[model samples]
Structures are given as structure tokens and as C-alpha cells.
Target: MVSKELVLKAEIRKENGKKHSARLRLQGKIPAVVYGHKQEPQSIVLDLHDFTEGLHHGHKLFDIEIGSNKEKLLVKEVQYDHLGKKIIHADLIRVDLSEKVEVSVPLVFKGTPAGASEGGILEEHLDSIEIECAVTEIPESIDVSVKGLKIDESLHVRDIALPAGVKLVTDPELLVIACSKPIEVAPVEEAAGAEEPTSPEVITERKPKEGEEEESEKKE
Candidate 1:
């Protein structure tokens, strides 16, 4: 669940583009944007260390306080540097606490499947599922128990039990994961006569052409 007291302090940005963004990075800040329905997109900058620390604190839904106005937002996308070690930019989507919004949360599988204990392989289709819920009701992660799952058994999105004001947004019939036995491929067997070449037909005699027969008899 998102913490009710979680809030992020952000500052409006006056510059954009690569050059200006690089200068922001040197100042220990990162470029960020927030936009949503009926709201004008706002350009801003965040303290890199502070922003990352909030994520480490397990904040899935952020209560962003910009200027005198506070807005609830979800982390939509994150841009990383070439090395993927540094945060270059981020996109935040504003949300309404009273209105339901869709967001993908990580899928957490708990307990060992019965098939897995019996030597069957467990395969997962997706790591997350989309859910529609109020900002306050958003879960940190959805837990799906695979306990007693047998071979050939599967779990779907419809099986999840959502919170009281939350609903599943993904396809109900979508297969989340399955338990199956490992397949053993057999080797191909060659036929006994496969390596040998076939014999050609034996024609007893070749008939001469009519003109050739006449010319041969005349020459003779």
C-alpha cells in the first residue's frame, strides 16, 4: 500500500534539451515531467539522491508537492544513462485519489507448486498485472499463491482477489503462470535403405529414327 504521508518536494524547471539537462545533472538534479487528464503538463527537476531514496523507501504512489499545490502521481517511465547506472530523466503521471486509475504492479508468487515438488517445471508468463484502483488503494505488489498447483495446472488473472475499491484491468483469461512436466525429445531413426542409391531401369534395345534407318540402309 502507498504510504499516506509520502510526499516529494519538486522544483519547476526553466530549461530543457540535452545541454541544459546535462547542466542540471551536474547540479545533482534530474529532469522530470508530470502530466495527466485535464491537467497541463508541468516541467520540473528532482534531486537525484532524494528521488532514488524515496523509491528505496518503497513508494509506489508518490504525493508530489510542487510549489503550493500537491498532486498525486505515479512513476510512468524512467530514462537511464547509457550505462544504465544513472537516472537521466523521468516521466510522472498525475492521478486522482478519488478516481480509479490503472497501474501495473509486480506479481509475487508464493509457496511451491505441487508439480514443482514432483519435478515439474514452473513457467511464468508475466511479472506484473494491471489493476484499476484509487490512488490510496494501490497495492505495493499482488501476491498469488501457487500452493498445491499440479502438473498441467495454470493460474489466470481472474483468480486474483483485489482490494475493496480495486479491480483487475488486465484480461481475465490471461494466463499468469503454469506448471508443466519437462519434455524429452527423442532422436530421429533412419530407414535401413535410406543411405543407398536406387538402381536405374534397364532398357533392352534402342530403336533407330526413321530417317536414320533409311540413310543407314542407303549407305549400306
Candidate 2:
């Protein structure tokens, strides 16, 4: 799914430091930096709620407005709190709509596999794949149909069908998904009659001492 155009408002940040960033977060905002396109990096602040909501909706490309200036930017990274539940900071890079960019697109498996009805387990090896496409043509996620796969069947990166302008950047031989027969475990009852081998007992004779032997000979 390709994302719809997403627009956000940003403001230039004059101060830098952990304290200032913490203060911003307290106001429901996030510290961010924009760089790329041979331009100097710009420190900016974005609304935490709006940016988080956009991300939850799978937005990657954004049109951010700063005062009278507007630029297209792509999400580069998002830092979260130590608990990984809160957004801390974000990084965005400038992009041109006309240029091609490489990004990782999520995979969505569709339908139950045919192998599932046959007592086979369906395994997913990859959750996302790297792809190259026009910035404007970036997809939210790629759909992979698993209904056609039968027992012991598999799908590789090369088997996926992408949008017209999208190209796979991952290795063609990488395994994407597979359906395999479930492993069969032997029942414990079947081992009841099996006898475990026991080690044989060993015997050793002790030799009589020299003085004892001589005394015994005299008695004889």
C-alpha cells in the first residue's frame, strides 16, 4: 500500500542539550534534525502526537512546513525511550520526489496456506525487505499471497511481485516464507519394552603376602 500525502508543521530549534530536549517532550513535542541534499543540517521540533500518529499509520515521506519554507523529507530514524514505548528523538533526511530511494518495506502475508490444512506449519522468515523505487512511489507494505503454497513449498525474495516502479534490493535467494510438514515425535509408550543394557560385574583375586604364604606352607 502506498501512503497518502502527509503534511506536518515544524519549528526551528535554537537551543541544544538533553535538558532542552526533555523540556520539549514535556510539552508534547519531539526534537528532530533534518539533513541531506548537500544542505546544512537543521535542528527542528515536531509535534509528538502528530508525528507518532503519522508513523503509526505507516507514513514514511512527509511534507514538513517551517515558517514559509516547505520541504519533502523521509524518515531516517526514530529514537525511543529506554522502555521503547515513548518517542525521544527523530531523524529525517531531505528528499526529492523525482529521485529514487532505497527503503525497507514491510511484508504482509495474505490468506492461510494450503499446507496448513495438511498439518503443515507455515513459517515466515522475513518481515520486511529492502526495495528501491521513486520517492513518491514508496509502498507502505508489500503483500505476499500464501494461499498457493503447499507442504514443503517455499517463497523467496525473487518470487514476490512488486509495483511497477519498485525494485527489490534484497538478495533474490533470501527465503521469505515456507510451508513444511510438522515434525513427528515418537510416543513414550513405544519405548516401554526396550531393555537397557547393564555393565557386567568384575572379580579380582588378591595374592597372599610372602610371610603368610610361608606360615601356611609350614602348617601344611
Candidate 3:
């Protein structure tokens, strides 16, 4: 579980469009908007550094303080530049603490697989799963143990143990992880021996013309 308190101080944004957003970035602020449920979209601007630090803390819910007003929101989506290093845009969803929200939770593997010790390969199929739970009850990640997994054995979404009040929204049959035996490759020597080269006697030799042969005899 990840629990942290983050406070973002922002002000209502009056301007819109690309030019206004560029100006806001130049002023060291990030443009953002809040909307969800029955609330109308509210445009605002927050300090770039503060907004980034809040995301770094791993708290899904945000406590946004806009002047004298406080809004509880969930980080719905975050867009970044082509390099994936800078934040370009963000969407915040207002949510009540008691309300259940559907969100994707990351999956984490715990313990080494038994098949690995037996020289079998392990494969992960899914990295995350969607689940619905109360905002406050949101889990940081779901854990699935891979210990004692034999070759051809798999763990599905339904096998994962989730926190109380959490209901999985993904298909139960979705594979999370599996183990398989290593593929065997035959030796090159055997493959080469299986192929036989063509015999020279089977090939037809071209015959020389009679005039060319007479010219060759005169030269001799």
C-alpha cells in the first residue's frame, strides 16, 4: 500500500488555447483541468515542480488546493512529450473518498519460480489489471507468487489475491504468468548429414561443335 499526502496550490486559469498554455509553461506553471461526476470542467494552473513531485509520491488521489478552495481528485491520465521526459498535459477526475472507482493496478511478481531452478523459462503475460474499489482503498499493486510453478503451469487473473472491497474488472482467464521448458535445438552435424550432395554422373556435359573441334585440331 502507498499512502502519502500531497498538496497542490493552483489558481483558476482564465486564458485558453496553445498560446496561453505556452505562456503558462514559460511562467514555470503547468496547465491542468479538473472534471468528473456532476462537476463542470474547471481550468487551472499549478506550479510545474510541485505538480511533478506530487506524482512522484505515488498517491493516486490528489489534494488540489486552488486558492481558498480544495478539491479531491484522482490522476486520470498524464500525457508526456515524445521523449517521455516532460509532462505535457494531465486529466484529473474528481472523486469522493467513499465512492468506488475503476482503475488499473500494477502487477508484481514475488519469489522465484520453481521451474526456473529446473532450467525452465518464465514468461509474464500481463503487467497490470483493472479493478474497482473505493478511492481510499486503492492498492498500490497486486502481488502474485511464482514459487513452485512447474513447466506449463500458469497463474491467471483470478488467482491473484486482492485487497478487501476490491473487485477485478479484467477477465478472470487472463494469464498473468507461466512457465515453459526450454526449446531444444538439434546439433548442426546431424542436420548436415541428413542432406546428400548430387552425384557428378547425373549431370549432362555439353558437347563441342564439329567445326570448333576441326579448328582445334588444325591449331594442334
Q: TM-score, each model?
A: 0.74, 0.81, 0.77
What's the distance in Å from true for residue 146, model 1? Answer: 0.8
Give residue 186's lDDT in candidate 3 (0 to 100): 78
**Please, what are the lDDT tens digits per residue for candidate 1 over residues 111-141?**
9999987788889998898888877777777
TM-score, cand. 1 vs. native? 0.74
**Candidate RMSDs in order:** 8.4, 7.4, 6.8
Compared with the true structure, model 3 gives a TM-score of 0.77
lDDT string, candidate 3, 131-162, tens digits: 99988888877888899798989999999998
Q: Positional deviation of 163 in candidate 3, in angstroms?
A: 0.7
lDDT, candidate 2, 1-220, per-residue tens: 7876689999999999999999999999999999999999999999999999998898999999998999999998899999999999999999998999999899999999998999989889999999999998999999999999999999999999998989889999999999999999976677567888988988888899999999999999
Error of 2 at 30 (Å): 1.3
- Model 3, stretches more than 4 Å misplaced? 22-28, 185-220
Worst 10 residues of 1 by lDDT: 1-10
Clashes of each: 0, 0, 0
Residue 136 lDDT (model 3): 85
Q: Which candidate wins on TM-score?
A: 2
